[model samples]
Target: MEYFLGVDGGATSTALALCDREGRVLGIGHGGPSNHILAPGGEERARSAVLTALNGALAGAGLESPAFEAAHFGMTGISRDSEPARAFAAVVAPLLTARIVRIESDASVALAGALACRPGVVVIAGTGSVSLGRDPLGREARAGGWGYLFGDEGSGFALGLGGVRAALHAHDGTGPSTVLETEIPRRFGRSLGEIPLLFYEGRVQRPEIAALASAVTAAAAAADPVAVSLVNTGAEGLAAIAAAVVRRLTWPDGTAAVAPVGGVFRAGSVILAPLKAAIAARAPGAVLVPPRFEPAVGALLLAMQAAGVAHSPERLALLAATWELRSRT
Candidate 1:
């Protein structure tokens, strides 16, 4: 049986998969950060991530020279117009005799994954936020994802910064008294006064700040009003992104299926419950649905399609079942 490859080059790390013609997963691999804009070493690091992952997958499955018929790479930080995808394709060209190679933004793949390649909307809220959707006619639209400097509302970075700002506000006696005043310090194991020093020395970076999102969620869970409000606002921001994309697409069903994916979604009911309500309010008939698969699996589905492999409903189900089985082991 022929095998295909799929790579999810995410902001934090890279994931690669090998699958059979039947869509059953054969092996999986992982590597370091691949985001071109945010990750260090840019194209070189991206190339290394992909190559190492492919090698790891092959080694894990005890294969010395696995052949790929086609491959797809779904990556972050590169837009549809970015040449990095082409560069990545070039990097892999010599490694395999694949007939087809395709690369796209992580947002596009997330949408494809959320809807199982069906036309629908997906909002990704991890360290960043973006929403993308496809119409039945293959047309697509996007909202947010402008990056942290511009947009990225409802993101972990945003939530973390918000928590920090709220702490400062309370410290200055300008905001409501909340647990964040102490929680922030306790979470970092630093005195509140030392936060500025940490930032000044560049000791606190995006990933470090983004980690504060967990503290915010914990505070909200403990019934802190300010934390609750922040969570609600973030959920609304995420909903707005989904609403904007849904507005641009022509849904075959009166309702568009909306799905949320990413680490931020791990906030659970603290985000999803309100996010569902907010999207429903703005985008009439928008239905929040469970994502069909992870981004890596979505890339696999797209790779199979690129190779002209038939992925009927039954086949997709088989693919999902196969992934479940492999993941458990």
Candidate 2:
């Protein structure tokens, strides 16, 4: 009857799950933004989000305080090289009744979630972007997770930046722009004339600017050339990241499977299509797997692994199916 708790704390939101020894999910919970790096009082915010979700899950399962055998948390902003990760772990450990509290990079949990702890590569394209791969020898390599400022190429931020660039280019008569010039203004309820003022007034977060990625996707789908080109370029960049990981890792076989996750992938396959093409061009036999579970479930899978629970193919399939169903609800 050993219970395990897993938390996936991301830039935009957080998720918590409780599972048993057999991998049966007992309860689940969710909370607000927990990207420790970006949030003021990030450590406290992360701790509160996780604890609230864990308590909610316990309450859902008809328990006052379920004793957990182990707890694993995957959070953004707490890097492997930094003290923030340790400090956050210490805060969580004392509150948990669990014997162990493990803290890891959110990317690790996302990779684990997609591959079920199996050796493979995962490319995440959310508000930010990163590619991580695990080889058969358990060696892990990562590329392009530098956040919105320096990197995050092929991410939401990238897409939004492209959108703005396209609009500005059109305004300046440097590039052929489309309806976005008008559409962008309509969506934001102001003319391009007002954009500078809004930005100067601190009405926009960097991520909020990147939030335009969704609009770009929709515009591309609706046949906007600028948007389409932006998506295609983004896909190419993501593919390049995946190929680099594949080249660095020593796969038992020449080919490796790559799983794509995050909002960018979930929004539409148009972005992924070019990425898949690029990966195939380089690694002809590489398999691109649709993510079987959200990263939170991957966090749970990692927790289960840490607890020494083995996963069977059938169980993994069941878990994937269950998670997909749960996600839709």
Candidate 3:
């Protein structure tokens, strides 16, 4: 009757999964953003998100007073052993009765879930971009993740902003004509000339701008040269990040799995093709693959590890099966 909990607390949302010793997921819960860095109220906000998700998970699992053997929190902006991590650990300590509690960066759990804790790199390109990798020796390295202001070159925000800039340029007759002029404006229901005001007036934020990436992807799918170029450039930037991680970590076999995770990759081959090609050119040893499990399950695996549970194929298989079933529903 040992229960384990895993929490994936991100910039926009938090998710919790509760499971049994055999790896069958009993419940899943979601809540608002828990990232202490991006939002105000820092620790308080993260604490609320974690509690909401944990309560939901407990309710869904029909467990009112079960003692969890272990719980892991993989949170964004809270690196292992850092000040933010320590603060979060203090904030959640009273809420959980787990014997073992571990906290780490979201990328740590992402790499674990993407490769099932095997040695690999994960390139996350949501609103922002980051590349993290682990070696067989448990050593880790990362590239990018500098946020939208200075970095995140191949992220949704980057692509979306690129589209907006292209639209503006086209309007000013400084750039080649493209459908982005229409496509970008259509997303905000504004004319091309009025789009800058949306950002200047604080009417649009990062997530909204990131959402524009879909329009760019759609335009690329429709064969707009400017949109296609933006997608390719974005792919190249992501490839560079992955390549940087590949270079930082040692691969005895001269090969490593590189999983692309996040919204930007939804463009499918429009982005993947260029990403694969660019990675081949930049880091030949890196291979792009689909993530084996979502980040929440990854956190669960870490929780199991802290509880001294072996990551046996049978246990992993059980977890994977449940993940597949849950994802479908």
Candidate 4:
């Protein structure tokens, strides 16, 4: 009757799932923004989100308090070595009744989630982008996770920026005409001229800008040349990240399993077409895979691994599918 908990404390929201020793998800819970790098009270916010979601999942599982055998916290904004990650570990360890509490970066959990703890590579493109890889011997490596300031080249934010730039160029008659000139204004419900002021004033936030990536994907689908170019370039950037990780690892067989995740990938063929092409060109012999589960379920697998318990990948995959279906409700 051992229970395990997996929490994904994200920048936009937090989700948790409670599962049994067999990886059967018993309950799911969610809460608001929990990215701890936002400062002011980022740690507190993350803690609250984790606690709230934990209680909700516990209640759903018909429990009074957390009495789990192990738990994994996939926290956003703090790497395993960062002070905040350490502080968070201290803050949360005492709160939960679980005998083992492990905290790690969201990217690490994403890789764990995608491969079910098997050695593999994962490229994540949400508000930001990062690629991580693990070898069979447990050696881990990463590339392109520098954030939106200068990196995140393949992220939603980067795609949106390209879209905005192309739209402005088209409006000024400096770039080839594309659907973005009209579509951008429509997506934002504002005049195209306002974008300049918004950018100059720093009012255009990352998420708002990243939202434009969808417009890029949509226009590319419509055969807008400028939009199509951005998608291709973005895909190349993402693929480069994966290739970089692949090069660093020692894969003697040269057949590496790669997975891409996040909203940027939601465009399906819009992004994947170019991404696969570039990965083939750069990281030859890499095999791409769709993720088996979301990060929360990956956290559960990590918890099980920490407790020295062997998990059936087939069972964990099934449990992840079931949890995902329940999450949609």
Model 2, 82-160: lDDT tens digits are: 6877778666766678876778888888999888888899999988899999999999899888888788888998997
Task: Score residue 158 of candidate 4 by CA lDDT.
Answer: 92
Q: Highest TM-score among the candidates is held by which one?
A: 3
> Would you list the C-alpha lDDT of every candidate in the order shown?
0.84, 0.80, 0.88, 0.85
Give me the runs in candidate 2 sitting further than 4 Å from their true place.
37-40
- 130-208 per-residue lDDT for model 3 (tens digits): 9999988789899999998899988999999999999999989999999898778888787877767878899867778
Q: Which candidate is the best by lDDT?
A: 3
Task: Give lDDT: candidate 4, residue 235.
Answer: 93
- Candidate 4 per-residue C-alpha lDDT over 185-296 given as tens digits, one digit per residue, 9 for 90 to 100: 8998888889868877988767788989999999999898898999999999999999999888978777899999888999999899889989989988788889878888
Question: Could you tell me the lDDT of residue 207 within candidate 3?
Answer: 77
For model 3, how big is the CA root-mean-square deviation? Answer: 1.7
CA-RMSD of model 4: 2.1
State in Å the error of residue 52, model 2: 3.4
Task: Single out the weakest 10-residue window by summed lDDT for candidate 3.
Answer: 35-44
C-alpha positional error of residue 152 in candidate 1 after TM-score superposition, expressed in Å: 0.6
